[model samples]
Target: MDVRKLAACVLVAATAGCTVVPGSNMNRMNSVWFDDTPEEYTPAETDIQYIPINATVLAHLNQQAQKQPLSNAELEAAISSYHYKIGLGDILTITVWEHPELTIPSGSFRGAEESGNEVKADGSVFYPYAGTLYVLGLTTSEVKDLVTERLSSVIKRPQVDVRVASFKSQRVYVSGAVKQPGIAPVTNVPLTLVDAIDQRGGLDEDAAWGDVRLTRNGHTRNISLRSLYEQGAWSENILLQHGDQIHVPRNDADKIFVLGEVNRPQGLPMSRTGTTLAEALASANGINESKADGRGIYVLRNTGISRDENNNPIYTATIYHLNAASAVGFMLADKFALTPRDIVYVSPAPITRWNRFLSQLLPSIVATDRIGDIQNNN
Candidate 1:
């Protein structure tokens, strides 16, 4: 359908639904007039704790933010004591002193990886003089000492060296919102969670760095990359182990919804670094100055579950009101922090966005009708 005709139809549908009351001059109901009484309305039931934004609230919130998140002490201990032990499918190069037959030389013809002793499923490898040595969960230095002791029976003052040729047994898989989702091999050098992420090409642009999940054994834990990188929380950077899974989820769930009287209403993703309420408002192009009440700005935050006086579980929510009509409003907004999934609403929005749209569109509708009539006459 033509835009002119569509607009005319819409206007007619909107304005033509008026019913006049009998024997009354001003009983006609239309867009401009409404006979709705205040008693006919039912306000929604809400348990709102409308706390005003002030220094006291700011201090309390700041104190809560200052409470540092505890790190994994057990994981930290394991990481500190961790040493690379030989596992099945791992390749090891055993070099014997003054002996060329026992050693697999990584020369121009074959690399060390190609000519290395692969650990069997039973975790034992057979060398020339060492026979079969069970080296499972044994470090390279231990294996070297074992080979030297075994060779001492045949040769006098036997020397041996053991090194990992290729690490294929143990790996940590990095998936989800990373630049490259792949596996990072466990090596002699310690591989931390951050190291594995870096190996997989770091986090993607849409990654919620604070929502990373690490699955070890059968259990999983939420690990915040922001705590490690931005807040200097070294303890949060736990070491990655074999069969571990690291997943950085997308930031879609971490977006703050901005609605109600705004110049440009939008959903802004929460930054892993930090995002203030002022920055969120700026992203939505500020408030609708004419229709919205600047002093009645509210931030609705879900504070999770809380118990009522009866001890029964009840859902808890907080409504924080900010008076932004004063000179220090912007300063207050700058200090206010917004969490993920928070909703911002500018109050007293008497006129809706649709009303603005119709006002702008009415002139064009009238012009189009005039043009159509002129064309019909010609």
Candidate 2:
């Protein structure tokens, strides 16, 4: 071959040798470029928890108060006479005009018990002539009319009056995820589920904001408080019923776990301000400079519950490559939206990993003391 051609051939051979091949050392090194691993250590634990980002966003979204628009059914129900049934913890007072003795105590005597009175286990007071009358559910007018009808037969021209002495029978329960959860009185004051929560001291910090559960009669309905308050979906502020229970579960599903090479490897709570991969890294004390390859950042997402054609359950996993140098990368980190129990990993450079492995094998031989000093100083 000519001298010039020979020289070109040698140069080409050197370039070819250096070219990266899949599964080769050069390829592995490149792979480690953006790996989310620490330089001097392997992941101490792989079972990092996942949290949903949506829940955090929703929580902040519910801070504002919005009036719930009434639906056709709700409107109709509101217009109609709602006869509330009496339950435990109710007291009733009855009076009969003209007939002093029949009027019970002969005058407007306000005492615990007087003439011709009956108290119910569910907190309702009944009258002898009124039969098994449940004054607990009846309004003042309804109770009066009922008593008048019964007295007509017993006494000559009997005029009867009925009133509630104490309101303890009608109550609704608020529990879970709320600041103060307990039974609240449902008095003449009209109250909705939101009002009940407010009366109970609002939702707790860890309460999930997406949907609060209304469990009644063994059936559950999800009400989105955030949407009701922020998105103008007022339908969520449902009117509460006696004995109805509202449960707010903790926001355990709205946090992300960051591990491997991070200074503070732990689970971080997500919020409405939103979180970015970079921000999360910073929150966890950033990646170990010596161990982290800025290029090898990965996000593992769990796509929940799928079914195969055979009706078998299948779980799918997704791996995302994040670029730290680009603005888009930061945006992705912020927008990626983590769910409860999500795992974020950063792989180290090949040289770093090798050094780490060697250090583990022979602590005395490796410069771990210097590495620790550098880490401490940094």
Candidate 3:
């Protein structure tokens, strides 16, 4: 035989070995393959290329929850924790002792004609007798001290009281899964995570009951709401700080999987509304029409167990089988909800076994290419 023909035979043999033939008798088997229904599915040895549906759903849910904004309750709680300080946009009400003429009716020492008392861009407030006094970064007490010293020179024993009328200077941001989201006014009142949520009008219907997150100074901390309310774990209720952001993200982590002989074998989103086997199969693009043995559908799940220090067996695997052709199959599907990474395999028909056997034998026959070619050429 020519070298070209030998090379062709080698190539065909190699390629055929890589091809897989579906089993034909997978549907005809009447006996159940599994003892009990598994809680989770394990991937087959041949499914190295497939993605783990549980991990995919987890990643997807995490992404969805991160995009939500903060609620109003969170904003108010944040504001309450802030210490009273003087900053831009703060309205100060200054009162002068025994000086009705100097004290304007509008509460500003600058007089009613000059408008409200405002902290200037340079951090100074213009008063009638005290001119421009820098008050930025100073607490309410500090501002009063500075003003009294300035007034000592102009008025005879000038008594002054400084109070913040509008708290627009300091604020905290609260967002995600809440009714109202925005910057909350900061005050001397202590604000906790629960108070923040209350200020935001409470968590939405889809809010995650697990962990609520607070971001501040480029650091993030996860606080469990369920632990705080249900478990009575008040340690999870952290005090909010100024410029802190409270976020109540939604729960999107619930999911189920349908794999193996299904056409679109993958993870399907779970609904609180409930789901059935037929529905899950439909979501996974339905069973493989040509390859699936409709008679012997099996759901394989791993029993949760871990090896101890002595290497003793800690877990046992459970399996469940349902005849797709049986009347009770649909009911079983609804009763058995698929968990993460569960494997659903549909066996092939009996003829598929013959085809696979023939495929294996075909490689040997092709090896006799030299004799066949010589016979044909002769």
Candidate 4:
């Protein structure tokens, strides 16, 4: 070699130390190495629970699914028993038997008579005999009884009927990932979870149906839309109250990201039935035949923190491994659920890893040589 070429080789060797391997450097950059003794904020592999994806793990998860807080029937009964209360801006139509003059105005000049009385902001409506009776915070039945008692003094046993002509008082808000997100007016018709959702024009294509959040009063509850529809967990369809805010979160966590030696490296959103490991692989068109290390298929999950049995704080993630070289491994993949935001990585074969290292390393090395040649030519 020429003196200049030898110097360039020496410089490359010195700058890129012999101990510095491309794989280790890339792993560090990717934060893939899990240390036993992790520094603060750096998660340790020991902190993570490593589980082999198998029938036993799948059985355990299936067992947990059986323990529901409320059944579908119970939820339906509770939500169905709800009664509507009168509120401000409600238009009430009160009918007094044998009193057409009092109920419906019949002035010939005005074609149709204005019969409905609008409940004012103060929560009371005006009538011929009742005269601005307090109706706010009262149910339709309660208002009818009150009107009956008030008119009894004027007319002897005056039969009275009260009905909501147009309900416009209370409203529930439906927002986020809905086709038409806005306030849905609560009327005489009892507004249930289903009603509010339908009023807002149902969920968008990108909606995270697995987790629908409902905020009522000061508290919030997560309702699974998937459970309600697919699993027939009708109890999830709870009654919505006034001032309630229903937000359907976007399927932002809806995707399971596939990386490494997969045929297609992309994020596949969970289907309506929920995504499984096998399904995610199928969406990505399975692993690369030549380059993939089927034995090294891993699912990385960050499960947040929790208290151990000793009451000590334990941060944990779950790294699930699957060796898909066998038929049983493929079956296990089908059973293993791929939760939202999960990272499904297919590690490259040993030969492929070397190719990857060289692929990344060669470009920089070539670029450096090109610069050196340009300077030499000048």
Model 3, residue 143: distance off in Å is 1.1
The residue ranges of model 3 lying beyond 4 angstroms of the native Cα positions read 1-82, 105-115, 254-378
For every model shown, the clashing-pair count is 0, 32, 23, 0
Q: Write candidate 1's Cα lDDT for 1-378 as tens digits.
A: 665787778677655442211111111213343556599775433354668887788889987765665565766788788889899999999988788766854353677887788999999998886799999999999998999999999988987889999998999999999999999999998899989999989999999998899999989999877767765666678877899999899988999988766789999989777788888988999988886777778888988766667766666778888889985887888889999999988764333433554676679788888887787788
Compare the candidates by TM-score and give the number of the best one. 4
Q: What TM-score does candidate 2 reach?
A: 0.58
**Candidate maximizing lDDT:** 1
C-alpha lDDT of residue 308 in model 1: 64
Please provide the root mean square deviation of candidate 1 (C-alpha atoms, Å): 10.2
| Candidate 1 stretches greater than 4 Å from native | 1-50, 69-80, 105-109, 306-313, 349-378
- Give each model's whole-structure lDDT: 0.80, 0.63, 0.64, 0.79
Query: Cα lDDT for residue 97, model 3?
Result: 82
Q: Is candidate 1 or candidate 3 better by TM-score?
A: 1
lDDT value for model 1: 0.80
TM-score of each: 0.75, 0.58, 0.47, 0.78
Model 1 clash pairs? none
- The digit string of per-residue lDDT tens for model 2 on 1-378 reads 543444456445534543322222212434422456678864321222333234343354233333445343673475364555444556666777876565554456656543435456654555666666766555767878877887788777777776656667678888898878898888666677778999999988788766689987788998877656556565677677777888888877777777766677888886533456667777888888776666666667776666667776666665556655555555556655454556677666556655554444344323444555576688
List, residue by residue over 1-378, the lDDT tens digit for candidate 4. Answer: 544576567557734543333452212233432446645564433376788888888899876764554466755675577678888888888888899887777763332214688889898899997877999888878989999898889999988888888778889999999999999988766788888889889999889988899998789999887867766667678777799999999987777898878889998878867888999998899899998888888898879877767766777788898989998998999988878889998877767766655676666667777777887898
